[model samples]
Target: MKKSDLALGIFLLSAIIFMIIPMPAALLDILLALNISIALIILLNALFSQEALNMSSFPSILLFTTLFRISLNISSTKLILTTGAPGNVVTTFGNFVGGGDLIVGIIVYIVLIIIQFIVINKGSERVAEVTARFTLDAMPGKQMAIDADLNTGAITDVQARERREKIQEESSFFGAMDGATKYVKGDATAGLVITFINFIGGIAIGMFRQGLGFNEALDRYTILTIGDGLVSQIPSLMISLATGILVTKVSKEADMGDILVKQLFSIPKVLYMVGAAMIFLGITTPLNVVVFSAYGLLFIISGRVIANRIEIAGIEEEVNTDESSADEIRRPENVTSLLQVDPIELEFGYGIIPLADTNQGGDLLDRVVMIRRQVALELGCVVPMIRLRDNIQLKPNQYVIKIKGTPVSEGEILFDHYMAMNPGYVEEEITGIPTFEPSFHLPAIWITESQRERAESLGYTVVDPPSIIATHLTEVIRNNLGELLTRQDVQNLINNVQESNSTLISELIPKLLGIGEVQKVLQNLLKEGISIRDLITILETLADFASTTRDTDVLTEYVRQSLKRAISNKYFPDSETTSVVTLDPKIEQEIMGSVKQTEQGTYLTLDPEKTQDIIHSVGEEVSKLENLGKNPIIITSPIVRMYFKKLTSDYYKDLIVISYNEIESDVELQSVGMVTA
Candidate 1:
């Protein structure tokens, strides 16, 4: 065992030994003195320390010391009643405390008891209780503040973690102290009981066994008992004072002594007024002229000195401020920090600020947090922190969502109004300001609070401003998640999978595929609105086919076939036949015929006229499905699926294309249209 651990264990063990074993006078003296020293050390430490967390172990220390002190009390009581003389420390303490009179010593002990019990212990207990409760109550606000700082780029993840840990430590410290204060109070009570027992027991033993008269016994044992009581209570009093100082301390900065002095005496005006009052009292009243007038003169002089110092300090501060400002203007700009960009940003105007501010009862910031979580759960990827900024150039209630510092979408709202969109079944039109829904550009109307209930009753979809922004932001993130997936993110995903299936990641990465290659395949999946949360299955599929071809596109195709069950469930439900389109075999063969391969990858070199004709036919087929109110899905041979998706992506952003190999047999399908050129 380490030396410190062994020493602490032995220290605790000694407390038990003290209660069990008999001790000589010399050893008892040394132990009593040591106990006094321990109490003094605790008092001084608590008095000077800056933060309450600095004494986080104080609760455990309180328990240990209380047990030890009670043991010492037991020892001293034994010697006082049995031997009538514990040690010179006790004998000398008795004489000094009694002042050769038992009554005086008794009165002094009673006062000490009152001060330690009713004043210090009681007050400390209440303060610790209230402080612990307050700390617990304020914890959530503090955590939210930390998260705000993190989201705004004011602090990094590491710094946020440290701050959160500090908050936890503080709450725990105060809570433990709340319960620990009772130990100090109980110790005082125990001291009172032990002291009474010693005095009564000592008097009886002295009179009966030592053959002393009643008065003589009273004089000897009363003084001795009082001495023992004083010895124990003085240390307990110091400890009690320490507890009060620690729990009552409010600030976490600098020494307690420094804060107390500055806060109490730093105001020169108060000092000057007090000095004037002293002078007035000395001159006007019949008070002692020398004593009171001397005090007033001293205060006036001190005030003058302090005021002069303050003036000089203010002038120096002004000079320093001027110098700092000049230096700041002359220095070269630090633009490195400005070079970085947020992955996702929501910039809004001042009129919308109230929606993001907690004090204004706005839950926009909370919605943003939920958006990140929702995206993660739906897409199986952790979204980067969305930074919210306020832009002044925009109109009131206008906001924009940006990807990598470039605005991609913008919206405006009327305060205290809800957006109502017709779901094609709401025949009765509500009278309101016409606008387009920012998310999908569908026609919507802004309705006031009174119109909201009626609009909902009329089968119109009603949403508040925050919900609109949150939905729009969610769509933007879903669209851009492919571009936002970095190699580092891929590595993190690999590490997560490696925790369970190490061999698969090890064989796939840096062998048949690099991180960027895996990132591309994952991005490809994400770009098509596929949830990559089933990472193990995805990696296992890659591991199976990655060796034959390092081409991520080809590998992604194979992985898709492996996840065909999920894809089938997503697009075609077994309960009903899904309407879809099928590519003509002749055009599929023609597409394959034009395909050319190079060192880079495969590309189609079909005639532009032919490509245009095929695209037009596909668009006609897609419109037919749209007219039928069915999703535009086209099935092709497994070899031509990826190329067909690439060709149609520019024309249709939300179209879904699947291969015959990517569908399950149990899924019912009906071809309502065909694409041909």
Candidate 2:
């Protein structure tokens, strides 16, 4: 064990032995001195600590010290009753206080016990109880404040976590103090009882065994008992005061002395008024004018000094501001800095600042964090950090979501209103400003807070302003997920997966396929809104077929077929039948004949008129499916699925194109409509 740990163990063991073992007068004197020193040290430490959490171990220390003092009381009582002498420390205190009168000494000791037990100990216990209760009650609000700061970017994750831990420790410390105060009260009561026992027992033993008279025995034993009580109560009183100071302390970054000086003298006018009142009292009463006048003069001088310091600080701040302004004007700008761009940026108008500002109850930053986590779960890749900025040139309530420096989606919101969306069939009409929801372009209205219950009762989905923006941003990022998965992001994924499945990563990366090639395949899957979360399966599939052909599109199709069960569960979860629109047999054959292979990749070589007719036919089929309230999914032969998806993407971007091979055989496929040319 380390030297410090060994020493602490020895010290605690010695305290326990002090009660059982009898010590000489010299050793007893030294132990008494040590006890006083420890009490003083504890009090000083409490006074100097910056915050209550800094002294988190104080409760344990208080318990040990209380036990040690009680043990010393027992050892001294043994010596006083048996030998009529405790130690030099006790003798000196008794002679100093009694002055040949044991009655005075006993009364003084009783008063000290009363103060320690009734005043400091009891008051401290009450304060600690209330502080602990309030601390526990306020814990939830404090935790929420930390989360708000974290979401607003005012503090990082590590800082917020540390603050939360500190709050917890503080609450626990106060609770411990509440229980530790009982030890102090008990110790004081024990000291009083022990002193009475020593006085009565010592008198009887001295008179009967030592053959002393009654007066002589009473004088000798009473003085020794009072001395022991005084010696013990002094240290006990200091410890009780320390406990009170610690529990009553407020949480701040400044020590008690600094806080007192700063707050007590914060206003100099109060001091000046008090000084004026003192001078008037001295003149009216028959008191010594010089004494009161001297104090008045001192207060006046101190107030002036404080006032001058405040004025100087104000002047210095103003001077610094002016200097900073001049420095900014003289600084040169770099034009190249303007070329830098964020991966994703949200620009909002000035009036919408409250949506991102924590001070105004804005949770936009928190929403953005949740969106990032949600996207990572659904898409299997982390999105880039979103940069939020305010643009004065835009409309007050408008916000724009940008990807790669280009504005992709922009919408407006009313801060004080909620967007109530009609799910296409609502019986009741709630009056409000008519608008379309930005996320899905659904019919919605900006309704007041009072109308929220009515809108919901009418079967309309009600959303707040922050949720609207967060939902819109989520869709925009999901659509651009392919572009967001950079080469570095792919490498990161491989490294993370290698930690658990190292052999799989080693066989696939830089051997069967390069990171860039893997990135392309992942992008292809993402473009079709497929989650690459099952990356081990994707990488294993690539390792199997990548040696034969380097075509990313063809490799992606193979991965999809391998994930057929996952795909089936996503689209037709808990359903036995998958409804889809199919191309006519003749149309599928005609498109398959037009497919041409080249060195770069495969290409569709259909005539412009034929492609136009195919698109018109697909559109008609999609409309018919929508009218039936069915999701539009196109199923075709495995050979022409990619080509057909490309053709319909421009006009029907929301349509899901699947191949017959991608569906599991257990899932029944029902043809809702057919596209004919």
Candidate 3:
């Protein structure tokens, strides 16, 4: 065992022994001094600690000290009654410190007990109880705040976990303290009872056993009893004061002394007013002029010194700030910071600032938080934290969305206007400024609030400026989710899955496919706008087919077929015969025949002219489906699906490509056109 642990064990065992055994006078004196020293140390530590949690073990310490002190009180009582003396420490305290008068000593001891029991102990107990109650009641809110920060990417998982742990510690500390305080109260009561018994029992024993008269007995035992009470009560008072200090501490991030000094004495004006008031009182009142004048002048001088120090500190702070800026320029380590880049950033100009600022009644931040949740649910991927910044170079209304520190999309919005787009049935064109929807590039118009109601009545879809930005941002993130799916992100998903399906994760990860390979498969699925939310099915499929091939594209195809139910529900509406274009059997054969396999992966080795012819034919068939007001979905044989999708990916970014195996058998589909080259 550790020496400290063994020492504590011995100390507790000694307390138990002190209660039952007849301790020697010298040993009693030594233990009494030790008790006082411990209480003083606890008081000072509690007074200076930055926060209550710094002394989380104080509740248990309170219990130990109370028991030890009570045992010493009993030991001292026994010595005083039977031996007619306790020790030099107690006798000296009875004679010198108590003024050698029985009434004076009794009065002093009574005041200490009253102060501890009625004032300090009572207040500490109440504060501890309330603090525990408040901490427990606020736990849910604190938990929610942590979750909000985690969701918005303001804090990492580790940081959130640490915050949660700190909160739990605080709750437990206060709750235990609420009960521990009762030990202090009970100790005080027990000491009062012990003191009474010592006086009564000592006087009776002296008169009857030692044959001393009432006056001599009263005088002798009264002083010793009062001395013993003072010895015990002083340490108890210190502990009570310590408990009060701990429960009342407010600041946890700085030194308690510093915080108190800053709050009480930092302002020179308050000190100056006090100095003037003291001087006025000294002159006008019947107070001692010399003593009051000395205090007044001291205060005024201190105030002036404090004012000058404040000014000097401010000057020094400014100088340090300037020096730091210059040092940053001179420092080579600055380059390291510049190399870091945000995964996603949104830069806007001044006009749209109100939409992003909550103080200006903007819900842009709330919308951004929701966008992350929306994407997580829709795509089963975490979007990197989106940083919002303002750029003075752009027009007031313009904003840019960047991925990996490079601008990919920019839009301009009228802060006071709403965006109205025709759903194609609205014939009444509103008089407004012409614009295009930022997310889809469909023709839209900027309309004022006055026109919004009329536009909606005319079957035109109207959206506010904040909604427009959020929608555009969501679309950009969704489209680029594949690129955003980092290896770390893949590992996070696997860890989450491992929490429940540990066997599947351990077998598939590192055994068959590595994180990078799994990331590639997930990225491929995301690129095709597939949801990997059902990770179990995805992992199970990968583990099944992984031994045959580690090629990510082929694994992704298998995973997609496993997720066919979700895909069918997503693309093909229930009980509806969806119109889709089909790959011509002849063209599928040609594409399969042109396929080339290498160690790296497979690629289409079709003739350049033939590829162009096939691309043109795919576009023609896609347009036919588009004109039919249907999504441009192309169904192909399972084997040729991935290659065909890759062949057309460059030409059509939003094209929906599926295979025959991925479609549900219950779902109906009609092929309106065929891609043939």
Candidate 4:
């Protein structure tokens, strides 16, 4: 479309003509030399052109050209050598090539020409795709931020992909090709340069044979080489030099060895043999062998040994460098200052946050914190003060001071009521009656004595700050609050909190928000504490959820929610009693037959039909919970019973439902139990 592209087209057509035409032998050689010359020029301009080089296309173009030419020359040379042509001519050029015979040459030429044309046609698009991929992979810590948004509901995959495409399109073209061409062109061109020089020398010999003396030679011609080795190599040498220089300059920050290695293989295998050609010629001439030997040594040093060293050094340097501020910003900071205490140490319980706006679950903490914050907002508390100070003391005995009620203070009642809701609380674990752990462990922070009294009167106690509170709080907040806060919610809650455009947290909001402490604990247990056998059980649970279910994501949520509740209470009663697992009649018979009874209960290996049927029912139960979305819905024995009863009831006559409850716990009905669906 542009002038440069048009020129390249013309050069390609000229090359096709040179390969295809049946011109006089001398004229054909001259045309081949000219064609090579023009190709070098076009390729150089393509490399340095203001018009961007689509690198993805460039390789195929180079490959097609190099292969096509070598095949053509070799085939044509063989034909000419085998024919009754002069032995001198056969020796000079090696053999016939291209269409070794007219018919073969035409077939080869047409096929090569078509392939070359197709490469050119598709080159631009290929470059675009490659550039796009490179931009994504090579971009720095920024990608993590991008991923955060992707995990959250902030950005869609299509949007992220589109942004990446746009960035690739805008980046500099030659900038991308720097390291690639260095080694490939290096070997190819070195051999080419030597050949061109030899051709020049050969042409001089030709002129001398025609009876021109030294003075006459100077007068007759300015550049005498027509078909010398030097002439042949000219194109390759220029291309190689261009590649090396561009690579060195543009990719200065890139590893030198990596660039060189890329170039080394890019040089054709035929080119190596061409370098060796000098040694063959040197058997007859003085300098031929010496020149080839030096060339080979140079290629070995620059293209292999030194290149590797440079790359290794560059990698080491990168390894030693400190992570940039951008990286730091992407990672969450453990801001465990006094005011922002760990929720875990606060004796606060975990709850799932719902993102009604998005399919992903939100952090329950953000909602709770938001409601608490509303108290602040409504009271015109422009700023809530939080401070961390060192080494403050409180009377340990005074922690259990009496509440100010007629019988029990309002503060004590609230504390008791809150503790009552916590299924994890065990009365035997407590030392004193009505003692509530002080949720906050603040030091002397210039608070009025009256403020302290008010806090204590509310049944709060002061104690030494817990060491693990920071990490614990961050985990709780991150798991509980991270998902529920939309950009709008964030903007409203905190005044001018800095935001990142490419945070992965913002991107995959739903998935991140959906994570719970139970899941985190399960992962840790599997990673560090669980036995291989128990690990297999966990994996089996995941696999069942994955293969039999429509969405593993939902099933995982359900399992996590159930696990969270169970672990918090230090009990798995729900899992023990009201399991969603339905034992087949055949499985029940097998278990009964085996009857390996323990003090607590019986255990038996399940059969194939039983396993399959259980797996099927589990999937159906999970599928029926499509209404729950990403959040796991808790199912109790009562709930399961009610569901079955409703299914058969006349109240839901129009709807189809199934009853399945062959499993029940041995524990009393009041004992909380878990059942992962």
Tell me, by TM-score, which candidate is best.
3
Kindly list the per-residue Cα lDDT of model 1 for residues 1-677, writing each as its tens digit: 99989988998998899899977778889989999999999999999988888889999999999998899889888888878888977777778976868889999999999999889998999999999999999999999999999999999999999999999999999999999999999999999999899888888998899999999999999888888888889999999999999998888778888898778767788877887888788888999877887887787787788789889999999999999988876777855657899999999999999999999999999999999899999889999999998999988899999999999999999989999999889969999999999988999999999999899999999999999999999999999999999999989989999999988878887887888889999999999988898999999888889879988889889989988988898888567989999999998998889888888988898889989998999999999998888889999999999988888899889899999999998888889888898
Model 2 regions lying over 4 Å from their true place: 1-333
lDDT of each: 0.91, 0.88, 0.92, 0.37
lDDT of 1: 0.91
- Clashes per candidate (backbone, < 3 Å): 0, 0, 0, 56
lDDT of 3 by residue, 1-677 (tens): 99999999999999999889999999999999999999999999999999899999999999999999999998999899999879987888888878999888988888888899889999999999999999999999999999999999999999999999999999999999999999999999999999999989999999999999999999999999988988898999999999999999998788778897888888888888888888888899999878888888888888899899999999999999999999999999888988988999999999999999999899999999999999999988889999999999989999999999999999999989999999899968889999999999999999999999999999999999999999999999988999988998888989999999999998998999899998899999998899999989999999999999998898898998999999999998679899999988988999999999999899989889999999999889988988989999999999999999999999998889999899899999998998988
Stretch of 10 with least lDDT, candidate 4:
403-412
Question: Candidates sorted by TM-score, descending order?
Answer: 3, 1, 2, 4
Candidate 2: tens digits of C-alpha lDDT, residues 1-677: 99988977877888899888987777889999999999999999988887777789988888888888888888888788777778899998888966647889977887897888788998999999999999999999999999999999999999998999888897888889889888888888888888889888988998999999999999998888888888898988998998899888885778899889999886789779878877877888888888988888778788888899999999999999999988876667654567898999999999899999999889999999999999999879889999999999999999999998999999999989999987778888889999999988888889999999999999989999999999999999999999988999999999988999999888887888999999999998898889999999999899899889889988988999998888888776765676679989888888889989999899888989999999999999999888877778888888778888988888888889888888888888789889987
lDDT for 109 (candidate 4): 33
Clashes of 2: 0
Q: What would you estimate as the lDDT of candidate 2? A: 0.88
Q: For each candidate, what TM-score against the reference?
A: 0.59, 0.54, 0.66, 0.26
Residues 567-666 of candidate 4 have per-residue lDDT tens digits of 2222323433322223234433443464444554334444556545544553454444433322122233322332222222333221212122211234
